[model samples]
Target chain A: AQSVTQLDSHVSVSEGTPVLLRCNYSSSYSPSLFWYVQHPNKGLQLLLKYTSAATLVKGINGFEAEFKKSETSFHLTKPSAHMSDAAEYFCVVSPIAGKSTFGDGTTLTVKP
Target chain B: EPEVTQTPSHQVTQMGQEVILRCVPISNHLYFYWYRQILGQKVEFLVSFYNNEISEKSEIFDDQFSVERPDGSNFTLKIRSTKLEDSAMYFCASRDGLAGEVGELFFGEGSRLTVL
Candidate 1:
């Protein structure tokens, strides 16, 4: 079984400040991890994915995440937060190709 | 870019009525999935389909829930009897299944089901 835990339910940051969202996972085997963002009333958009290729993955909108195996963590980070970045983010773990487990989600609020 | 699309953005139904949610996945995608999220809750996976059969499903997908790919393009989820608890936003997602491809899912806007 694979599961992901998002440490924070909500996080607020001022514009131009660094942003961090924490996630941890438990999987039986080497797993595939992903970060997805969902805006209000919109579908989820893939931010980035870790497929055991790179320890640090860069994604769109200046977002990035580092995959740490020992710590079982894949935390999303951005050098600076923008108002457009305010949304709900999910950490997902997949044991196989099609099945996925999503974290509770972290609501990000960017204040201008 | 090609994207998944869902129909009936919102539906209101009386309890015990059957509701079917429809989706059209990306043309070349081979894997299809259904997920649901209650208001303010985490998204939950309901089922995954490949080769016109279910590959995996969650415990929440009970006897009352079923899925089908009736045609080449349409994927549908049918709930036999709706309950108030079933009210949520149902999302349909698809993934390109090329071997060695990363497991990235493309999602539809979702259908909001309201069981009254």
Candidate 2:
């Protein structure tokens, strides 16, 4: 079985400042990791995905996450936070060929 | 871009009443799934369907739940009986990929079910 843990239940950042959301995973085999964003009352939107390639992956809307195997972490980051960035972020992990698992999710609040 | 779509954005039902939530995945997608999220809880997988059969399912998917691809376009999830705990947001997703390979699964906005 695979699982993901989002370190924080909620994270707040000042607009125009940096943003970081932490996530860790436990998987038996190589895993595929993803970051998705869901705004209030909206569906989830894919942000970035790590499919066993470059450890540092870039995603839409100026967001990125690094897949660190030794640390078993996939932390999402951005240099600047926009009010639009405020939303619920989910860290997902999947096995080589199995069902996907989602974290409890981290709600990001960008304060201007 | 083609995306998944669901019907009845919100439905209210009495306990013990049957309700069917519907979805239409991407036209060429081969795999389909149903997931639910209780109020302020993590999303939980219910079932995955492929090749006209179920590929996998979670323990939460039991005798009360059934999935069907009634036609070439529509995928529906029927709950035999609703309970108060059944009030939640149900999401439908679809992916087209083979084992060991990966593909994106598009998701719908979600259908909120409120069982009284």
Candidate 3:
């Protein structure tokens, strides 16, 4: 079984401030983790993924996440948050050939 | 920059009515999936298809839900009878099935179904 937990349901940040969205996972086997962002009324877009390569993975829009095996965490971070960064983010876990399990999602609210 | 495409951006239907959501996945991708997200809720996996058949499905995908790849380019989800709780945004996604390639899925804008 594979599952993901997004620690925060909502995270508010001021424009230009740092952003962090936490996620943790439980998988019986080695897992592939992903972070996806969904803008209002838009499709879910892949932000980044970790497949046991680098511990730190960089994604589009200046977003990055570090895969911490010991902590069982993959927390997304951005040095500076932009107004456009306001969106709902999901953490997902999938085995090599199984369905992906999604987290409840974290709604990032960027205040200008 | 290949992407997935879905049809019927928004559909309004009465209870017990049937709904069909269509999608065109990225060419050359061999794995397909259908997911849904209720308002303000997390996305839930419904089913995954490969090699012209279903590979896996979730509990939410009851007998009322079905998927098919009719005509080779179009993947579709059919609901025999939609209930009010079935109202949600349905998303289509595809992934390359090449060996040793653990690729991310490409998604479509999604079809919103409103059951009344």
- TM-score per candidate, chains pooled: 0.97, 0.96, 0.98
lDDT of 2 by residue, B1-116 (tens): 89999988999999999999999999988888898989788888899888888889999999999999998899999999999998999999887776566776578999999999
Instruction: Compute the lDDT of residue B85 as modeled in candidate 3.
Output: 99
Pairs in clash, predicted candidate 3: none
Poorest 10 consecutive residues of model 3 chain B by lDDT? Answer: B96-105
Docking class of 2: medium
lDDT of 3 by residue, B4-110 (tens): 99999999999999999999999999999999999998899999999999999999999999999998899999999999999999999999886865679889999
What DockQ does each candidate score versus the true complex, computed on alpha carbons? 0.73, 0.61, 0.80
Which whole-number lDDT from 0 to 100 does residue B107 have in model 1?
93
Model 2, C-alpha of A99: deviation from truth (Å): 1.6
Q: Candidate 3: RMSD over Cα atoms?
A: 0.8
TM-score ranking from best candidate downward: 3, 1, 2
Point out the worst 10-residue segment of candidate 3 chain A by lDDT: A92-101
Q: TM-scores for chain A, candidates in order?
A: 0.98, 0.98, 0.99
Q: Which sections of candidate 1 miss by over 4 Å?
A: none
What is candidate 2's lDDT per residue for A1-112, written digit by digit as tens? 7889999999999999999999999988888899989888888788999987799999999999999999999999999999999999999986644467889999999999
